[model samples]
Target: MSTELTSREVCQHLRDAALGVRPLQVIGTGTGQVSVDIEGWRLQLEFDGKHLHHCGHCCCPDGREWALDSRQRFGTDPVSLLSTWELAQIEGLLRRAE
Candidate 1:
């Protein structure tokens, strides 16, 4: 027999895995999801139906960061400011938060 997991269970699992890591400060539409913006990396978590989608973006210096989307105008991109290893660490934390 197979047992399904509840939302609470999933959340707990995520929380447990994310211990000691900084939480993502998500800002977006009406969704109980989370995202993180550190250095120049943008990591977003989207919930579709019962599944979760993880998306990430790192902006490089120059005008590229400013030309990607309208949101770029609001603040600087984290990618452009962080090194490759730093970006990877942030991404890892974001993934654990899921």
Candidate 2:
């Protein structure tokens, strides 16, 4: 079964990967995006400043993925998309575009 994770869990998992705190860890970061690979998931997230822009995830590297946004409020928003920084503890990890 697929698992649903909190923002804090996402942030911590990424942090651990970046710090090489785990045996199986792969991570990459670019201008406004970060990619991570977990045992059964691949996650890519984009951010504008401290706000999330987009999120993509799939069970397999070459499989289908889903898109979701946590920063904008429009029609047909996914449930529980807004993830607060307070809960994530990633204030310093995310930065504004220069």
Candidate 3:
């Protein structure tokens, strides 16, 4: 029998994979907020479904505000461009949740 994976496990796996890559960026929507989890870095944004308000937490290193500009173009969509392994792990977590 195959063991089911939990969301925490999935997240941890993703985190580990992110560590392998030079830079990582994650975008997801929260309950009433939107968050960006780049590797282990985190940034939160509040939106009223029209305008967005940043929470002053940006993952880009100092003297690199341009990076934020680059990230902005990516838009918001969790798991939009995940790898096959990542998608499988997340699907496993979702299945376990059901």
Best by TM-score: 2
Candidate closer to the true structure by TM-score (higher is better), 1 or 3: 1
Cα lDDT listed for each candidate = 0.38, 0.46, 0.40
What is the TM-score of each predicted model, taking all chains together?
0.30, 0.40, 0.26
User: Candidate 2: where are CA atoms >4 Å away?
Assistant: 1-26, 57-64, 68-87, 90-98
lDDT of 2 by residue, 1-98 (tens): 44444444444454553344632233666777766465545666665456545455433433544555466455322213334533243323444112
lDDT by residue (1-98, candidate 3, tens digit) is: 42432223333434454444433333666654555554444545444344333233334333222122334433223233455565454334333322
How far in Å is the alpha carbon of 51 misplaced in model 2?
3.7
For candidate 2, the per-residue lDDT at 29 reads: 69
lDDT of model 1, residue 96:
52
Of candidates 3 and 2, the better by lDDT: 2
Model 1 lDDT per residue over 1-98, tens place: 32432233333323433443434443443364555443333344444434334332322222132122444432233233444454455447644545
- Give the runs in model 1 whose Cα sits over 4 Å from its true position: 1-33, 37-76
Candidate order (TM-score): 2, 1, 3
Which ten contiguous residues of candidate 2 have the minimum total lDDT? 89-98
> Worst lDDT window (10 residues) for model 3?
61-70
Task: List all candidate RMSDs to the true structure.
Answer: 16.6, 7.0, 13.5
Model 2, residue 6: C-alpha shift (Å): 15
Model 2 pairs whose backbones collide: none
